[model samples]
Target: MLVILDLNDNNKLRIDMKKNKSSITLSSLCGIIIALSTSCSVMSKEYKTILIHGLQPQQLISASATNVEADGASYWSSYWGQVSDERIDWPSYERIEGKIATDWIWPKLKQFSEANLCDSGCVLVTHSTGDLVARYIIDNQANWLRNAGLQPLNIVATFDIAGAGGGSELADIAVSALTGAASWSFVIDQALTWWLGSDVTEAVGVLHDLKVNNARKISPVPDDRAPRLRFVADGDDFFGATKLFLKGSDDGVVASHSSCGASRVDSFGSCSRHIASDGQVGHQGNGVSGFMPNHYPMLMSDNYSHNSIRNAGHKGKVTVANYAANVGGKQVSFQTYDETTGHWFWKKQYRFVADSNRLSASELIYDAIP
Candidate 1:
């Protein structure tokens, strides 16, 4: 006999069977296991979030040695920070190499599959050169998802901060300098040695090869049809100058010109229909303090520089606010607070409106995703 336990949560029920029953058949136990497993599976299969850090070679070391816990989000196991070995590829270099290597494919695929938090789908939170890696994963891992019995649903969201979505002008400058087109080979070499380590020559060569290969497949403009939540900060030093130097438009660190799609506003306009305006929030001034001030040259000088801007201490609030405004439902809610005051700014419970425009890059990512 099956005893039904009413789980307080509607649509969920638990079952209990008496242990003393000698007549309990194997088929009956199988039925009970199947029922419980199905319920647990449904519970486990919900919208999951993953954080993918970009281009730091050091992350690989940490992943291998540290008891890294989930930072409230699944972290792709990879070395993404500084490196002691010059021969090892950094995050940026590895991404390019991984794209070329057939074996690297399974690791990325498994990373996503094991983090099956997104029964409904998932959101990819990425930063800097990491956005390129995210794109590479999405483009190449479609087969992996199919094999794992998972479907790529709405991206749910994407947060790209100071992304080098378009190629870096600094990269161009380095190439010119090293190739004798520019007169700053000595200075360029010194800078590379100082930041990228003594192995600058090999790193640069690897970067160049990756860039060339990436150029063939990826476009500056992301597909409009893909449902995404995006954000861009204004004072982004890299895109801004890159816009002038490469594409001829300002994108904080990455030039909008180099970016594959329309200008920021234009891209927003096209995707605005999918973005929910009610979920929108905007910030004024440099997103963070303590960052160096030089705009154009910073991209080349500092490895951390980018064109994206985000509000200080307010990213979480903005994310919660935007998610609720654009894509609300029982599974979603909104929350906000002030950094300086430590005060609640906004809080609400709501469901997504189907007619709302999808969240844009300007809405969710800039200051928050990191």
Candidate 2:
């Protein structure tokens, strides 16, 4: 005989018995019951963690087409740990205008959602260009899935590490140089090496979409409800070689405006209007200066390089910030850290000062994970 057990949302258990040559042992029944009981418990809510990777040229040229968490975890695995249930891998070399989304990414997301995300809910973890990929998905997935007569994914939120959603100035320089519109310079060589492994003769494909103006044009405002939490850095691994070509403060590869999810592409110091990139006193007021709709800059570090921010082992020094959602299209302050006490003070206890508050990047990321 074949026996099966299942649990519904009501916590009620259902058993199915089917005629078969295979028999079920008493121990096996007990194990099944125990597993179901533990998994279906009211206190324990099941959730899947999904990872999306960024610009990796190597992934595009590989013999195999598909790359998943099972194939190998992303660089973020150090902090996220071995917790990825699924991964959305795409050909990084292709342009964002191509069928990369429909062919390479959407099918995997649809399958994963139907199989796991619809029931379990999921958290999206993305890095670099993956942030841009995620924004496109978040904006379109609901209507697309509904049209196909499929249930939309239950996405809790997105964690964007060194996000490039606002695009980078380096891409503009690259495209200009490759097209001969602008002369090639040392800045282009070093910047391309940092991002693509070497200086290239062509700046076609994904680089086209990564241009500062082009990226903003694609998705200026998101319609999705899921919150986008940005993790940004200011340290330049290139030692000022690539920084000169970039606008404002940068983490070698991406500028603060892009990584911080600013409303517009411009020179910016920090995520907050109240704090400068140099940790000096900055302008006051909650007025919208750098915020993208539904985008929040959660953590930042002047000591963290673009590569170091994702590695848990690095333990780079960082500062964390958060704000309440838009009420009538205006953001409100939520909490502030008191450096002396080493504790966060709520709005009611607002004692915020424009000073550098230090903490480990890993510590902040670990505390924020669901």
Candidate 3:
């Protein structure tokens, strides 16, 4: 005989057994005990966190595929240390493009909810284009939750790495360079080759269409009520072009001119603000930087060139640390650590807490924890 427990609320199970009084024996009883123990082990499994990876060409190449469970726990468990389910590679961009609509993203959320993966709102950590995709899904889901009368999940925090939050200026430049009859620069051609793949002409054409048809229809985000937006650029980033791109006063390859938008709260008449990484962290360091004098690298690298900032994982870690340290507070903290010594060798903290009168408060917030 075999017994099974149904974990889902539907409360159903299937079992296979032979009913024979003469055949019942001590061996069968022992087997049942062993099976019950195994079932208990499965039911008791727990996860400390959930991590969703950024967009990639294929599922196998995605960050989630590398070390799914462990990566989630390391970067996204919680600020105060709590156990939670870690979801990875769910409804990835590769899956989205193949499906031709973003509808898949929501189903994964529903799946997580049904499975009790995110009891509290899950912390979302995304990179590059994946950041935008995730945001789109969340925004849509929030709308759905409101309509369905479901309690909104608590979004602890969002960690967007080198996100193309604002439109990419390099993308604009590439489209302009390709559309006109003007002579194409070798650098531009190489960039198209590297980033968009071999079919440079067609890729540029598609990008142009997307920008003109889709991007133009979207209104700019208002300044006062923009979403809880934060920027992590490389001082030397070339791909995103933080060095070549200039916001009103900042230089992120994507440009604050294009990236900064009205906060989501602004639409609701709520007060909010935008944040950015500190100085000495531009396109290459902690800002956005591209290689080949233009394109930004994906993560951290020692080269410290235009592309280096995006390539360094440490910068993304810094951004998350800053967000965690300042939750419910009006400050952002940043620090740099030594690999070998495992100590914070340098630190720069900022406390931008404002009072009811919109004045700076005396509360002190450190940039570096250590």
Candidate 4:
């Protein structure tokens, strides 16, 4: 018996098995390909979305302990629903050393890599210190996988929510309070307890990693080209307590420089290279001019707090009154609504204020997913 396959004159697949012959039209061939693509595994592409969570108060208290109830690692379920296929949970109390990424995180990632689960590509959603951890992964995952005789992850992009990759000044302050480097005032003690759920008199494990300079020193720039999309908020959820410790504009916990992926920690009002003196939301511009390499700020809101941005709850409504070419620049257009007159259009800069309805930051981020 013999078999042969070839394209017919009519652009159809003609297969001959011994004395029997059959032809499949182009549409039929496409249908067959689609049907067999699953069994043909090697030809199919699988895309996965992985969620890496931020620091937990319980983890911050003790690296060796686990408090499932206090951990927000599973909060992504509310924001993204059931889209995430994998979740990477790490102890926020561990340093970015042997145990944190090398032992704890690596095993999970290695398993996924070895399985070639994301053969096509993946989108990572990380929050706070997870952003810092992801940068390390992006920098080393490929080499680590190849060294282990496995395939590397094809990370298409990363969504960094309240990213602390640039490090938070609060970490520095916390260390200062712990080491007695700075005066341990009543205010500092209260703030740390409020945030960490404990006195946190000792800065151990990951607290050192969260220090502004230290975090920046760890894989600040990744070799991978995956873009880091940042979602930031300027609301003071901590009741204006932690804000004094942070620089410029902040999402209560992290300063805008860190959240926006600024190359250097500074007082930056907006993530864009341009800023408006009159105060307008900085719509993140493309490229690496104003931000860290491969980092791009996506959404910004005055109403969204650090915690609210990651949840499914509706914060409230906001009105976009103007659109500008750049922050602080002349407004190119404007649209405002009034109770009596309805929407009025004109030329102005981009401005968001407390008013009519708009999507929450979580919804906006979810919608932005490709």
Best by TM-score: 4
Q: On residues 139-164, what C-alpha lDDT tens digit does candidate 1 reach at each position?
A: 54555566767654334544445444
Evaluate residue 353 in candidate 2 and report its C-alpha lDDT on the 0 to 100 scale. 19
**What does candidate 4's lDDT look like per residue over 21-123, in tens digits?**
8887654555356644322332222446688887776655555567532354465667653455677777766787658787677897898887776776777
Residue 104 of model 3, lDDT score:
45
Give the alpha carbon lDDT tens digit for every residue of 1-370 in model 2.
6666554555455556775333333334444566544233322324466778777655534426636343335555665544456677766557665766877677976797577554656668788888898888888888878898888787767878889888888888878987899987776777667666663566666778888888887756667778888888888777687787777778888888888888876777778776544333336343228578888887677777777776665543355455444322323233444333234553222233123234345445534455
Arranged by lDDT, best first: 4, 2, 1, 3
- Write candidate 3's Cα lDDT for 320-349 as tens digits: 213323322333343333222123756434
- Candidates 2 and 4 compared: the better one by lDDT is 4
Error of 4 at 292 (Å): 0.8
Model 4 quality (TM-score): 0.74
Model 2 lDDT at residue 132: 91
Q: Estimate each model's TM-score.
A: 0.45, 0.73, 0.46, 0.74
Each prediction's whole-model lDDT (CA): 0.36, 0.67, 0.34, 0.69
In model 4, the runs with Cα more than 4 Å from the true position are: 1-46, 67-77, 273-289, 317-358
Best model number under lDDT: 4
After TM-score superposition, what is the CA distance of residue 181 in candidate 4 from its true location, in Å? 2.2
Off by over 4 Å in 2: 1-46, 59-74, 276-288, 323-337, 340-363
What is the overall TM-score of model 2 with all chains considered together?
A: 0.73
Candidate 1 regions off by >4 Å? Answer: 1-46, 57-90, 95-105, 145-155, 179-182, 185-199, 203-206, 209-216, 219-225, 236-252, 258-370
lDDT of 4 at 194: 60
